[model samples]
Target: MANSSSTRGTSLDPRARRTRALLRAAVLDLSTEKDLDSITMSDIAQRAEVNRATVYLHYKDREDLLLDATESTMEGVVEAARACRLSVDTHALPDATPTHLISLFAQVDQHRAVYRQMLGEDGSARCATRLEHLLAQAWFEQLTAEPPGSPHETALQVRAHFLSGAVLAVIGRWTRGDFDGEGEDGGGGGGGNGNGNGMSVAEVADLTWALIRGQK
Candidate 1:
C-alpha cells in the first residue's frame, strides 16, 4: 500500500517505471468506460499494450493495479496537506489557512474522477478507508502541535477522524454533483446559482475552512 519509498528505490528502473505508469493510466482510462468489477488483469494489460505476465510482474492482480493507480492521487492530497500545515506552522503563507486549504482543494478537484470511483457507492472501500486513515493521521499530527491547545490523546484521535471524514464526505458530495447549480433549501433561500457542475475550488476551500473553524 505505502509504495512511495519503494517506488523511488532501485526496484523501479526506468523501464519498470514506464510500465507502471502505463498500467496506471490504462486502468484509469478503462475505468471511465466500464465498471471496475468487469475489469481484469487481461483488460488492463491489453490496454497498456503489455502481456498479462508483465502485469503480474509489476502487480499481483487487478486490485493491486487499481490501488496503485489511485494511491498517487491520494498521496498528492496528503502531500498538499502536509505542505499547507508546514506553511501554517512556519507563518510563510500570507493568508495562511485559506490559501493553502484552497490549494489542497484544487488538487482534489484535479483528481475528482479518481475520488469519485474510489469513494462512491460501487467503488473500492479499501481505497476510501486508506485515504481517510492517511488524512486523519495528517490532521492528528497537525492538531497535536497547535496553540489553543491539543486535545487529550483519545479526543485528538476522535477529532482527527472527524475532520478527515467530514472533509472527505463533503468532497465526495461535491465531486458527485451534490452542490450543482441552485436549489431552494425549503426555506426558499436562493441558491448559489453555480455552473451546475459543483463549487469552484475557492468556494469549496472557503466552505471547508468554515466547517473546520466551526463557523457557519
Candidate 2:
C-alpha cells in the first residue's frame, strides 16, 4: 500500500519520497532478472541511489516492502470497483458483469508476472485469504456503522470467510489455467456458465458480491 503522506494529499518529504521511489524502482528492475529472495536491501539501495539505512527507514524487511507493492496493486482494484460504485446499482446491470469484472481482472492480468511470481504456488491463495479478511473487516465496519443488524457482524464474518475462499478458489484456478475458455459459462463448475457458458469474472464477482450483500 502507498504510504499516505497527509490527509490533504501533500507529497511525502523529499528524502522519504526519494527513498521509497528508489526501493520501488529497484524491485521492478531486479525482479526482471532475479529471484525476489536473491535481491538484497543493499542492492535496492544502490539501484535507488540511496543507502541501506535509508531503505531501513521506510520498510521493515524485504517481505514488508513486497507487501507494500502488493498493496499498490490492490489499491488499483479497489479504485476501479469504486469507479463503478460496486456498492450501488448505478449501471443498472447485475452486481457483477462481464465488462466490469473482466476489466478489473484485465488490470490484474497486466501485472501477471508480478502476481504470478508473488503468488508462488501457495502464495496467491494465502494472499487472497488475507485480502478477504481485510474485506470482511471493511464489511463489518459498514455493518456496525448504523443500527444493529438481525444476524450480527459475527455471522457476516463467517460468510465473508467462506466467500473469500470461494473468490480465491476462482482466482487460483484461473491462474493455473483452469478457466481459460470458461468465459461466462464455466463459473459454477460442469459448464453452462453456472448453467449458461464460460465462467466469466463479472459473473463470479456478482455471485461473490451477492453473498456479501446478502450476508445475514
Candidate 3:
C-alpha cells in the first residue's frame, strides 16, 4: 500500500487541495464523536459540506481518507524521536526526560482520541503499521549515525523495530487509558489536554526514557 509520504509531493489543483483539507478536517472532527467503524462516506460528505460523489472523487473509501487525515499527526512524533539523543551510555543519560521525548508524548496526547480509536483493537492495521515503519526508520537513522563500532545492519534493523514497537505499544496503551491513575497527578481526565489524571505526557515520557536507557 502507498504510504502517506506518497502524497507529499504530488501536486493537486488549489480547489482539490481545499476540498481534501475540508474532508480531512471533517473526518477528524467526526472521529472524536463516534467510532470510525460507524462513520460512513455519506456522513463524511455531509460534515465536509460536499456531496457524496465528491468524497468518492477524492478517496477510494473511508479508511483511505482516515489514513490521510491522521497522517499529519504522526510527523511530530517521528521528528521528535529523530531529534532525541538516545545515548548508549546509560550513565550519561539525563535524569529528566528530554524535551524532544516530552514533545513526542505531548503530540500523541494532543490527538489522544484519534489515536485511541486508530490504535485500538478495531483500529486500522495500516495506520499502525505505517506509524511503526516511520518510527523504525527514524531509529535506524540514529543507529547508523553512531561511531564506527556500531551494530551491523541486521542488528540495527532489529533494534530499531523493537524500539519503535515498544514506543508504539506504550502510546497505544496510554491512549486506551490502561495506565490511568498509575503515574498520573491528581488532575481529572477528559480533554486530551495532557493535564488529565491518567498519566500525563511528562510522566509517560519519563517512564519511556527510563526504560529506553535501561534505568530501574
Candidate 4:
C-alpha cells in the first residue's frame, strides 16, 4: 500500500488535475462494465486515453485509484449527512422532502452506479470496510461534539457504531432498489418530487432520527 503522503498532495497543478480527473472518470466508466479486481491499470489508462505510466504518476496503484474515487464520492455523502444532523430540527416534525435527507440521497443518486457496484453483494470488502470506518469516525465525532449524553464511553462508541452501520445498510439497500418508491411514511407518497412509490425522504429521516434519539 502507498503511504498516501507520496501520492496525496495539498494541491494539484492544472495538468495534473486534468490527468487525475481523466483517470478517475476512466475508472468509473470501466467499473460499470467490469469488476474492480479485473480492471487493471492498463484498462484505466486506455479508457482515460493516457499511458500506463501516466496513471502511475497520479495514483499509487489500482486499489489506490479506486479508493480515491470512492472517498471522493463519500465526501459528498458525509457532508450531506453532517449537514442533516446540524440543520434538521430534531424537535420539529419533518416535512415531506426533508431538505437535508434528499440532499444526501441526491448525492448517492448522482453516483448511483458506482455505489451499487461497490456496495453490491459481490462488492469489494475493502471498499465497504473503508466506508464503514469513515462513517463510524464521523458519527463518533458528531456524538462527542455535543454535550455528554451517554454515561459510559463504551456505550457511546457502541451507539455510534450501531448508527453508522445501520445507516450504511439502509443506503446500501436503497441503492439495491429495496425501498424504491415505497414510502412507509404514513402520509401520501413523495412530497411531489419523491420516487414513484411516494416514499418521502422526510419519513426516512424521521425514522433515522427516531432510532438515534431512542438510543440516546
Best by TM-score: 3
Minimal lDDT window, size 10, model 1: 184-193
- Put down candidate 2 lDDT per residue, 1-216, tens digits, no spaces: 334322212456886776676687677666555555567888888887887887777887776666555555666554443343332122333544445455555555545444444544535344454455554554444434434443566765675456445655555555334555643223223331233344444555555456545532
Residue-pair clashes per candidate:
0, 18, 0, 4
**For model 3, how does the per-residue alpha-carbon lDDT over 150-199 read when each residue is reduced to its tens digit?**
66878888988999999999988787777774322221254236454567
Residue lDDT tens for model 1, 79-116: 66655562123333344255667777767766666665
TM-score (C-alpha, index-matched) for candidate 2: 0.60
Model 3 TM: 0.89
Candidate with the greatest lDDT versus the true structure? 3
**lDDT tens readout by residue for model 4, 1-216:** 222336867578999988888888887888667666678999988999999999889888788888776766787777666565431123443433346666776676666657766877777777877777767766666556655453366655776677678877876666555565432222122332365453345555566666655423
TM-score-superior candidate, 2 or 4: 4
Q: How accurate locally, in lDDT, is each candidate? A: 0.69, 0.52, 0.79, 0.66
Worst 10 residues of 2 by lDDT: 184-193
The best-first sequence of candidates by TM-score reads 3, 1, 4, 2
| Per-model TM-score versus the true fold | 0.80, 0.60, 0.89, 0.76
List runs of model 4 lying over 4 Å from the truth: 1-6, 86-98, 180-210, 213-216
Overall local distance difference test of candidate 2:
0.52
